[model samples]
Target: MGTTTNIIRVLFISILIDFLEFTIILPLLPKILTYYGRDTGINQDSLYVQTMSFVQFIQNLTGAPNDAKWNSVLFGGIIGSLFSFLQFFSSTLCGAASDRYGRKPMLLLSMIGISVSYGIWCVSFNLTIFMLARVIGGLSKANVAIILAIVSDSTTENERNRAMAWIGAAFSLGFIFGPLLGAFCSQWGIAYWPNSTMMFFIVPAVISLVLSLINIVFIIQCCPETLPIAKRDSKQTTITDISNKILPWHLFKFTAIHNVKSVDDIIILRRLGLASFLYMIIFAGLEFTITFLVYNRFNWNSMKQGKMFFIMGLCMALVQGGYVRRIPPGKEIIAAISSNIISHTNQDL
Candidate 1:
């Protein structure tokens, strides 16, 4: 029992770190890009330059004040999208690899990959190196799914939802603290090391790197293999398996076809997946847009943006921690679906 408790504790910290790494960039991205843009010798034809020009044109048409700062937000969005694209492919492969080998190996590898990327960020001097870090870091995005699987393995069905709630709470807390820490580190670096370029972004990245390394060491010392040999998936690696790992669409087919026990289950799962996909499409656009909107309207810096995110994280934490557990699973699903439908309808109006 103590072992199980330790595993869950470590996994929770791992999840928190995963989210912290991702959200830390939210407040720092514009500043990072603005620093990148000051290079007068950058090629005009480069993708980054072209993207900035295009965004500037859009700003002109919208009657918004033309500031080089908009370039940073747009460039950041493109890099973030690139990360998401890489994550789409890597998630399937990592999940499958875990099933074949064991959870501990995959978790350790994923954490190491994340740490290495952050280390790269700490030393990166150009856009190419920074984007490379984003790509490598995003490719290890399967840790959250693995953490969920681990929770499933460790808990009884009755306790699974409660464990998941705590994980979600940790996620909110991570976001709450991540932006604050990033803002603080950036300001601290600027105050003490004004000559160092990218210190604002690099310091936060270094902090993330240190936490990841600590988490990796903790897992190596303590986390045991939860999936026994008898329960482990076959280790066979066929051509189809390889293809499934590379193609994101194949993940949908793999999960739906292999896991669905009934026609009703298939319908329900597909509907939920469709809803989630549509919601994300809209959410991504809104999330990206709001950053630019707030920046243009309020002339806010990274610290102010971090405060905004803190409010969002605080609300999410309160709702998940205080309210989610009181509801039954069946009712929760119904409420979620109903709320989404109403949200869509209101947007249309």
Candidate 2:
């Protein structure tokens, strides 16, 4: 529970690795779309067809003439939305599973799943396979929530903000290095392996796979289970139970059922939840669209885009690590900021 323990450091490192793996693909997405769009011949069975159909629908909706230039942007946005949407669906289930099982087991499982997803991505040959890889990655990722839970389990109310600030800094560090690494590998792939199909994506995917494997090993060796035996859930929750719990009607059922300490407290919580929801929507839109904006406007390749993201990451790290330390924000303000950070940081690339 102490900040000095190996657990916090390991968790921090693990979360950093996770973010690196997640964001490494951001710069490579345009290449992915190009690959699929070029190669998707007469195969109606491909996911590319469905994606194009959806793209066409959007094009029609806006009364805009069809343009090949916008294909990557539209495709990337849809793919990114799919990934985040799946995360939204599965997060509650994963969080509950972590509670019922142990955090260590759940974290290890999630990381391993992510590793496999990256491995699959490295070898993916088609649009369908690549999108499937994204699906697997999205469904497997609930580590951020669990990692934060681990932070909360260990820190006191007064110390929690500072502890979380470090985690936020780690998140920023990941964003800083992840895209840079992607750019390096991408350039390497283009320079040395020009003949290979999907080299642009393969290079970054391989890097992500390697980092994920290392993270998995670190978690197994260093991350001790934080939930005590007495506090662990005894109920053997099956898939059905989890499915039922995550049903739409059940989302706010707990709040409805629980006894409130005060009407004002309930009102405050509802406001926080609403604020968090709106913040996530806006931040996620920005995060997903940034790659498209840079690629189209500045004609930036993966490496140049990575440099831009590196600057953003540097700014984030400076604010979180330096500014927050000098003047710690209040809990409510931190909570709102945390919501924004979680949405932006935890988004799947």
Candidate 3:
């Protein structure tokens, strides 16, 4: 039990650091896009310029707004979508690999990948390199899911919920603090090194890299192999099996589950999957674009953006910690419906 408790604590810290690195860039996305867009030193034939031209061409073709602010938003959106797309595929691969290998090895690999990504970001001089950093970060972001798996492996069924709640709290705290820290670092960098664009971004990247390196060391020294050899899935997962998992199927017709024979069960599963999928789409869309929206609409800088996210994260943590957990078990569907209705109504307003 003491070992289990220690493992959970380490995993919690790992997740908190990962999310801090993840959300640190949220308030800076718009600024990042704008910086690359307006920088005149970039060669016209370079990847950054070519990519921006392609994005602008697509915007023109699609009749997207043709202004600097809108262009920044569009570029940020494209980058954000690419990151998410890569994550979607990499997450499935990582999960399968963990099942085959031990959890610690896969987790270490993920952390190393993330650390390398941040290292690249620290030296990213142009948009192309920055995009590459994002790609690597996305591909390495299986830590959260793997952390949950570790929690499951280390905890008894009766203790799982409490452990999961602690993980959730780590996420909430990360969201609450990460952006503010990033904002402070960014502002400090800009103030101290006013003439250096690289310093503005490098400061936050360096901090993230340090945290990742600490996580990697901690895992190597302390984390144990949760999946014992006797309990391991020895069946070699083939390419086709991995492909099936990675491919995105229609939400209304989920084809992943092989054992459910009842039509009613299938229908219920599909409905639930569709609901979750749509909810994520909407939530993620807003979350990504909110930075750009505020930047464009209110002319807010990083500090203001950080404060906005702080408030948002605080509210989310409060609701989840205070209200959501207390809802009666059978009333989950009703609660979900009510929350969705309220969320959508707020959006409309």
Candidate 4:
């Protein structure tokens, strides 16, 4: 196959899997809560807290605190903490593993892990089970890491921008389609309560599992390993003193080191990092908030949610496809961001 073909194929596969993961699960969450014994957000915007309290009441009465979804917030902090801890723990380690084990195994593991997580999600009556599933899922796979590693190993510096752009396109396409599919499956129990909509998670998990297996057995098998053994072993090269050696990934740290040649570089890097972090946090919260609103405030079914997301996706695609795409890379983008800040500042006035 041509390099271009391979690139497209890889990006398509990665984006497809990611879309399934994100969209399929999200739409059905409304239904998952259906069987939990309530319309939770009924007649009140403050029901978020009320739902948690009610879940707690059930917890004390049933003595199985985890069974109540809303109550997960009350004491699920420990589990949440553990989940975050594991995500941080696994991210770098998984990337390192790909460098050593070759990308295929690590990527395959991630898919399988997530599938199992969703499967557990389908029946997650207790918070502990959900937490465990997430933890295990987080640690299991690093497909993005592996795919990027493959691209790095295969493509030159110049070709990388286009390579990654295509990957991004695939991701966008996934976002465009995954929600609709999830929403479609969600209709299986739209008339029922949110909690009993277990099929939403289950069906997608089954689909993703099949897709992953197809990739693993067919597409992946056709793809050759990019990192040769000699290069891979470089990360684990032996000193006869095994006790003295540190792991490859464990060696990199972001601690303060006084080895900087330019304070300006430090400041610039800090600003960039801070901006990125803020953007990520804001975007995540906004997304979750929107999903919650659509699910609760409207009592919308999966297809509606899917259609809503589809229209949103179409707008986004147009924005990126046309002049707005320029806003990210050049003077235009900087100007646009600047204008936004000014508008926000004026709004505060």
**Which candidate wins on TM-score?**
3
lDDT of 2 by residue, 1-349 (tens): 4544556688778889888988898777777777777754575346788889999999889875677767667778888899988887667777777777888888888788889899999988888888889899889888888898888777777767777878888899998988888988989988889898777788889999999999998888888888887887787867666655566444433342245787787677666667666767776876777887778767889999889889988988887776664554555577446646764675554
Off by over 4 Å in 2: 1-5, 43-45, 62-65, 235-263, 325-349
Residue 261: error of model 1 in Å?
A: 2.7
| Candidate 3: pairs in clash | none
lDDT of 3 by residue, 42-83 (tens): 453276677778779989899988887777777777788888
In candidate 4, position 21 carries an lDDT of 62
TM-score, structure 3 vs. true: 0.90
Kindly list the per-residue Cα lDDT of model 1 for residues 1-349, writing each as its tens digit. Answer: 6666777787777777777766777777766766666676545235456667777776777775555555555566667677877776667678777887888898788888888888999887777677778888889777777777788789876777777877888888888888877888888888889998767887888888888888788788877788887888885788876786565466544441565567787677667767777778777765555566567667777788889889878987886767675668678787676656754675531
Q: For candidate 3, which ten residues in a row score worst on lDDT?
A: 36-45
lDDT values, one for every candidate: 0.75, 0.79, 0.81, 0.57
lDDT of 4 by residue, 314-337 (tens): 655554444343444436547647
Clashes of each: 0, 0, 0, 12
Please tell me which predicted candidate would have the highest lDDT against the true structure.
Answer: 3
The root-mean-square deviation over C-alpha atoms between each candidate and the true structure, in angstroms, is: 3.6, 4.3, 2.5, 7.9
Range of the 10 consecutive residues with the lowest summed lDDT in candidate 1: 248-257
Scored by lDDT, model 3 comes in at 0.81
Residue 162, candidate 3: alpha-carbon lDDT: 65
Error of 2 at 212 (Å): 0.3
